[model samples]
Target chain A: MSRTNPNAIRSNRTANFLIYALCGIIAFVTVYPFLYMLSMSISSPDEVVKKTIVLLPKGLSFLSYELIVQNTQMWRAFGNSVLYTAAGTLSNIVMSLLIAYPLAKPKLVARRFFTVFLIVPMYFTGGLIPSFILMHTLGLYNNIWAVIIPSMASIWNIIIARTFIKSLPYSLQESALVDGASEFRILFQIIVPLSKPVMAVIGLYTAVGIWNDWFTALLYLPNSNLHPLQMFIARLLVFNYSSIDPGSRLKLDSAVTQTGVITQMKYSVVMVTTLPILLLYPFLQKYFVKGVMIGSLKE
Target chain B: MEQVVVQTKPKAGRIRSFLRELKRDRQLLVLMLPAVLHVLIFCYIPIYGITIAFRNYRIGDPYFALGAAARWIGVQNFLDFFKSIYFSRLVTNTLLLNVLTLVFTFWVPIAFALLLNEIASKRYKRVVQSFSYLPYFVSAVIIVSITLNILSPDGVINNAIQALGGRSTYFIGKAVYFRPIYILLNVWKTFGWNAIIYLAAIAGVQQDLYSAARVDGANRWQQMSYITLPSIMPTIILLLILNVGTLFASNTELILLIANPNNMDVSDVIGTYVYRMGVVEGRFPYATAVGFFAAVANFILLWTVNYVVRKKTDEGLW
Candidate 1:
C-alpha cells in the first residue's frame, strides 16, 4: 500500500482512536476508586449521607481530617508504621547487599549452593503455624522484632541487587583488589558508592512493602499499640471499628451526626494510610519498573 | 597403580583448590555471615519445625520437645483434617477462587499492553500508564475498604440503583457476590502493574519485523497477531505457568479482610482456615497438617506444570 493511501490513512486513524479510547477507559477505571474516596472524605457529612457525592466534593468540610487528627490510636499506629518502614528497609538493604555482593563474585566458593539456598525459601516455606510457633519460642511475639526480622531479607531483592552488581565492570573490583583493598573495603567503599540506582530501587520496594504490610503485624503483634497504620485502617474498615477505643469515637450530641462522622472517617483513614505512597509514586515508579525488569531477566 | 594415581590426583587437587578458594575469600564468607545466620535462624528453623504436624502440639508445648502431652501422633492430624467437615469446602473454595481469579484477571494485562503499544501519541500513553499504576501502590486494606463501601447496602452502587427506582442489593452480605467482587478487585489492583512486564516484552520485539509486515500489506491487527504476539509468547507462557503454580494459594490477606459470617461459606479457603484453627482456636497440630498438605500440593503442582511445559516447549522456571 502507498504511504498516503486514503483507505490506509483512515484505517490507521480508526485504530489509533480505538486504542486511545480503551486506554482512557482503563485508566479511569483504575483511578475512579481513589477519586471517589477523596471526594467522599471531603464532602459534607450531610451530602455524604444523602449519597450525593459521587465524583466530586460538594459542601466541602475537613471534619473527617479533624476527627482523624484527634484519634490518638491512628497517630500512634502511623508513628509505628514509620518506624517499622525505616528500620525494616535499612535491614533489608543491608542484608540483601551483603549476600548479593558475595554471590555476585565469580570467585566465591560454593556459589551454586548459596544460590539454591536463597532460592529455596521463595518456592517453599514452613507454613504459618510453624513460623508462628518459632516466633513465640524466640520471644519475638508481640514485639517489634517480629515485624522486622522475619522479612529482613527477600530472596528476590537479593537477586535483583546481585544482577545489578554483576552488570558493573568486574575490572573496578579487580583494580581495587590490586591496590591492596580488602573485599569488605571494596564492597562498602567502591561498590556501594556506585550502586545508588539499585539501592534506591531496593529501598523504595522495601519501604512500600513494610508500609503496606498488615498480615505480619496481625500474626505476631497481638498488642494493639504495636499495630501498624495499615492494621489500624484494616480494623476500622473491615472490623467496623470494633477494636477502636470508646474514647476515640466521635462524641456527638446525636446518633445521626455520630454515624455520619464515622462514615467519613473511614474514607479519611484509607487516604491517610495510602496517600504517602501514592504521592511518592511518580518517583517510585521508575525504580520499581527497573527492579522488576532486573528481577525478570535473571540468569 | 596408574588408575589409582589418576583418580586420586584429581580428587586431591579439587579439595586443595576448594580450600585455597575458601581461605582466599574468607572475608567474603565473613560478609555472608549475617544473611546466612538470618536464613538459618528464621527460614530453616521454621522448616525444621514442620514436624509439629505430626505431634499433638498445644499452645505452650515446647517445640520438638518429646513430652507426654506433645508426643508423636503420627498422621492423626492429617487424618483429622481429611475427615473434617470443612475439608472439601476449603479445597473447593481455594481452587475455585484462584481459578476464577486467574481466568478473569490474567488476560486483562495482556490486552491492556497490546492496546497500549498501539497508541500513536507517546505523551498520552505515558499519562494513561501512570494512572493505571496508581491502584497497585494502594494497600489491600484500602482496596477492600473501597470495595466494601461501594458495594455496601447504603453505599454508592446501591444508592445509584435506588435512585433509579431499583431496590438495593446487599452485595457484600451475599455469598454469590464474593467471588465476583474479589476477582474484579484483583483485576483493578493488579492489571496495570502486571502490564509492565508485557510492555517490556513488547518493547523488546524487533522493529524490523513490524516494518517487514507492514511492507507486505499486513495491517495493524495483522502485525500485532503475527509479529508482536508471537514474540511475547514465551513471556505469556512462563507467566501462565507461574500463575497456575499458585492454584492453591489464595490471597489470604484480602479474604480475611472481606470475609464475614454472611460470606464465610464461599470465602473460606485453606489460608483462612489455617489462621482460624491455629491462631484463634490454638489447634496447632491440625492447622499445621492442613497447611503442610496445601504447601506440598502447591509445590507438586508447580513441579508438574514446569516439567510438562519443559517437555512440550523449551520454557520452564527451572
Candidate 2:
C-alpha cells in the first residue's frame, strides 16, 4: 500500500504556489554558477572579468575553450580519464555481479564471513598512505593498473547489488535449476536481465567515482602525462590561479589568469569530462534514484 | 557502522548438513564463487597492507614485503605526530569541518526533500530535482572554481559589494570565510541529490498517519512538525548517526582545491594535511602514522556511537 494519506491531499494551491516559487529561486541559485561558467568560457576573457557582469555575456568568443583544447595536456588527461572510467566501471560491474549473484542465493557457505569482509572496508580503511604504499609494492605504481585496479570492486556496491538481487524471488533461480541450466548460465542469462535497474544505479555510481577520482591519480601517478582530465585542470585552477600573490605587473598577470577566464576553463574541463555522466543521467534517472531505507542503519 | 549490520550470510552447517545443503544446492554455491574471489583478492588483500601504518613505510620499499627484516617503529611515528606542532589543529579542523558540513549539507537536503515531497505536481518536482542533481554530477573542480568566481574580489558578489559603497574583500584569501564557503559549496553541490533519500523515507510513511493527524485537528505545519517529522525520524536518526560515525573524514578535494599556504592555519584538516605531507611531499612513515591515528580515532567514534545507539535503542550499527 502507498504511504501517502488521502485526507491530507487537500487543494492548498496557494501554499503550493509559494513553496514552488521558493524552490524555483533555490534551484536558480544552484544552477546559476555553472551557467555563468559556460557562458563566460565562450565569451572573450576581457569581457568576462568585468566587475559588474552577472547575466548576459559581454561578448562571445571561443578563445578560452580554444586554449583549453589546444593545451595538449588537457587532451592527454582526457584520454587517461576516459581509460580510467571505462576500465574501472567494467571491473566494478564484474566484481559486483560476481559477488552479488552468489550472496543472493542464501544457501552459500561462509556467506557471513564473505559479507563481513566485503562490507567492513566500506566504513574505514588504512587511509591513503598505506594503500599507496601497497599499490607501489605490488608494482602497479606509475601504471594505469594502479588507477584501474584498486577501485575495481567496492564492498558497498556489492552489498547493495546483493540486497537488490536477494529481493528477487528465489523461484526464478530454482526454476532455472530444475530446467538443468547451470548456475553461471542462469546468472548470466536470467539474473542479469532482471537486475538491470540496480546494475544501472551501480554502473552510474562506479562511473562517477572513477570520473571524479583525482586522489588516487595524485597518489600513485606522479607523471603529469598520466594525470586524468579532472586532476590536470584542477591542478591548473588551484595552482596557477594563485601562482602570483598580488601588487605588481606580475600580480596583474596572475589576476588576469586567475580571472573568471581561468576558473571558467576549469569549469569547462569539468563540463567536458562529466558530460558523459551528465548525459547518461537521463537514462538512469528512471532507475538510479535509490531509496536509503534498506542499507541505511540497523546499528 | 551502517554496513556492519547487514551481513546477509547463511549460517554454518555441520559436516552432514553441509554435504546435505551442498548436494541439494550446488548450483547456488557455484553462482556465488566469483563474488567471493573478488572480495578476498581486492578487499582483504589491501587490508593486509594496514601493517604499513605500523612500520617505517616507504613507497616501493614496502615494510611488509621485507618480512622479518622490516624495521619496526612500534608507536614511534604516532608519538612523533603527537609531539609535532600541527596535531591538534588537524583534529580540530577535521571534526569542525565534519560537524559544519553534517549540519549544512546533510540537513538542508532533508528539509529540501521534505519540501519537495509536498509538491503535488510531479513534473515540477522532477524538474527541480534534475536541476539540483545536475551539480552533484559536476566535479569538485567545477564547483570550487565556479564559487571562486562568484565570490572573488571583482566578481559578482564583490562587485555588488562595491556598488553599495563598500570596499571589495578577498573572500578566498581570508581564512575566516573558509568554513562558511566550504560548507555552503557542499550544500549547493549535494543538497538536492541528498533530499532524494528523505523523499523516499517520506514516501514510505503511511497515509494513515496523516489521516490520523488530520482527524486529531492538526494543521499543515502541525502535521509536518508531528506526523511527518516523527515518521522520518528513523531515517534522520540513522543518517545522523552515520554522519557522526565518520566524524573525522574530511573532503580532501574541497579543502585541497580551496587551500593555499596563506589559509593553511584554518583550512588544513586531517585529510589535506596528510595528503600534503605524505602523498604530495613523501614523508611516508610520519604521514602514515598520523593518518593511521586519525583512522583509529574515527573507528573509536564509530564504535562508541554504535555502542551508545545499541544500548539506548537496541539498533546497533554492527
Candidate 3:
C-alpha cells in the first residue's frame, strides 16, 4: 500500500489528522455539558444566570452543594435511592441465581417451556398503566417496596447467570452429588462462589437500573418525601422550568422567590444526584464491560 | 428459523433414573424458583394487563372485554391511533430519530470496536477506552439536566454561540433541533458503552483468519474488510434487528426529560406519551389503551424482525 503520488500522500495524512482531530472535538463537545454542569454547581447562582460565563467560574462557591446536601428532602431521597438500589440488586441477584441454577442443568421438566416462558416477558411488557395498577393491587403503592419488589427478578440477569452456570464444569456439581451433598449446599458453597464475576456484572446492571429508576418511584412511590433522587431532581427541573418561563418578569422572580432554589442551583443538585453514579463506573468498569460482553447478544 | 425440534417423547427414562436425575436436579429447581417467581410476579402478572387493551379499563371498576363498555369497538383504539392527526408525525419522527441514532450510536460503536481492536498501543487504547466508556454510567437525569444547562439561553453553550456572532438558539424550544439533539446526546452517552459488545465479538473472531490473510499479503484494510467485518456481521445484524424491535418503544425518561410543549410535536414518542397520558392526566383507561397498543406494536415489530432475520440469516432471537 505504497503511495504513488506525493499529493495523495500529503492529502491522506491531512485527512487522517483531520479525522482524529474531529473525533477529539466531538468527544469534547459530548463531555462539555457535564463539565459545564460541574462549573455551574460550583459557581455563584447570580453570576451563572447573566449568561456571561466562560469556561472557568467567575467566582467559585459551593452554595448549591451545601444547600442540596443539607436539605433534609435531598438526604431523604438519597437514602431512599440507596436503599432501593441495594435492596433491588440483592434481590435481583438472589432470584436470578435461583432460576439460573436449575435452568443450567438439563434435567428439569418443562425446561424449554419454562425457559421460553421466562424469556418472553423480557422482550414485551404489560406497559405502564397496568403495571402501575398492579403495584396498587399488590399493596406496594407509596411503599419503598414499590420500587424494589416489581423489579426483583430480571429475566436478562437470569439468562446471563444461567448461561454462565451452564458453562461451568458440570463434573464439580456431579462430584458433589456423588459425595452426597444436597443441591442447596452445592449451590451455596460451589456455584455461588464461582459466579462472582458474573454476579458482579448482574449486581452492577441491577444497581444502575435501580439507582437511575425514577419512573418506578415516580409511579409507585407517589409520596414526594419518599421520592428517589431522580424523581426529586425531575421535580426540581420542572420547578426550574416554570420559574424560567418568559412571562412577566415579576412573576418569574416571584416563582423563584417562592422556590428559593435558583435554576443554577437545580443544575448543581443534578451533580449531587449523579455524583454517586459517576463514582460507580470507574470501579465496576471491568465487571461492567465483561457483563455487557457476556449478555449483549442475549437479545 | 427452524424451531428446535423438541421431541416430546420423554425419551423413556426409567422412573428410578428420572428420580435420580430429579433428585440430582432438585437443587436446580430450588435455585430457580426465586428468579422464576420474580419474573412471574413482576413481569408475567403485569402482562395480564394486556387484556386491558381489549377492554374498557377502569382503575377501580370491574373490567369488561373488547370495547364492551362502548359496544365492542374491535381494533378501534388502534384505528383511532392510526387516524389521529399526530400518527404520521409520531412514526416519522421516531423512525428519523432511530435511524440517526443507529448511524451514530449503534454503528459507530461497532466501528470503534474495530479500530480499538487494531491499535498497537495497548496503554493508549486502555486509557481512551476507559474515558470513552465513562459517559454511559451517568444517569439520564444528570445527562438531561446537564444538557438542559447547556441548552438554556443563558447557559455556557448559548453564551458560546452568542459570542460567535450568532443569534442565541433555544435548542430545546425548537421542534426542528430536538431530534438531532436527542440523537446526539444518545450517541454521546451510548456509543462507547455499546462498543463493549462489538469489542468482545471482534476479540472472539478466529485469529487464524487474520494470519492467513496476512500471509497472502493482505494489508490492514483488506484484512479488516475481509476478516473482521464479516466475522462481526452476525453480531451487528443481530443487534440491529433487536434495536428495530424497539423502534417504537423510545426511552421514556430521555424523551420526557428533554421534551417541553414546544417540541412535543417532534419529541412525543409512544413511551413518553403513555406516561403523560396516565401519570400526568391520570386518564387510566385511555392511557391503558395506548400503552397496550404500543406494546402490541412492539411485539409485532419484534416478531416480524425475528421472522425476517431467521428466514434471511438463519440466526435470530427465538
TM-scores for chain A over all candidates: 0.93, 0.81, 0.87
| Pairs with backbone N, CA or C atoms under 3 Å apart (clashes), candidate 2 | A3-B207, A98-B35, A99-B35, A102-B32, A299-B316, A299-B317
**What DockQ number belongs to candidate 2?**
0.41
- Fold similarity of candidate 1's chain A to the true chain A, as a TM-score: 0.93
Question: What is the lDDT, from 0 to 100, of the residue B162 in candidate 1?
Answer: 91
Cα lDDT tens digits for candidate 1, A77-122: 9999999999989998998898889899976888878988988888
For all predictions, the C-alpha RMSD in Å is: 2.9, 6.1, 5.1
Worst 10 residues of 2 chain B by lDDT: B2-11
Interface RMSD of candidate 3, in Å, is 2.7
Model 2 C-alpha lDDT per residue in residues B71-165, reported as the tens digit of each score: 66678877878878898888888898888888778779878987887788899988988888778777787677667767877678888888889
Give the TM-score of each candidate. Answer: 0.95, 0.86, 0.86
Q: Tell me the tens digit of each residue's lDDT in model 1 across B1-318.
A: 844764767887978877998999899999889988988877887887889999977777888675565688899999999999999999999999999999978999999999999997899999999998888888898889899889989888988999999999999889999999999999999998999999999999989998888888888889899999999999998999999889988688889998999999999999999999998898888889999999998889988999999999989888
Per-residue lDDT value at B40 in model 1:
80
Put down candidate 2 lDDT per residue, A1-299, tens digits, no spaces.
12255544543556677899988988898778767766666665666666334766667766556556666677788899989988888878877887688877776766666667666777657677766666766788888888888778877778778888888999998898899998788889999999887777788888887888777776788888898977786676656632212223223444555575664565466567666766787864555566244345212
lDDT of 1 at B111: 91
Candidate 1 vs candidate 2, DockQ winner:
1
The worst-scoring run of ten residues by lDDT in candidate 1 chain B lies at B1-10
- 1 against 2, candidate with superior lDDT: 1
What ranges in model 2 sit over 4 Å off?
A: A1-17, A44-46, A49-52, A66-71, A241-267, A291-299, B1-38, B58-68, B310-318
**Ordering by lDDT:** 1, 2, 3
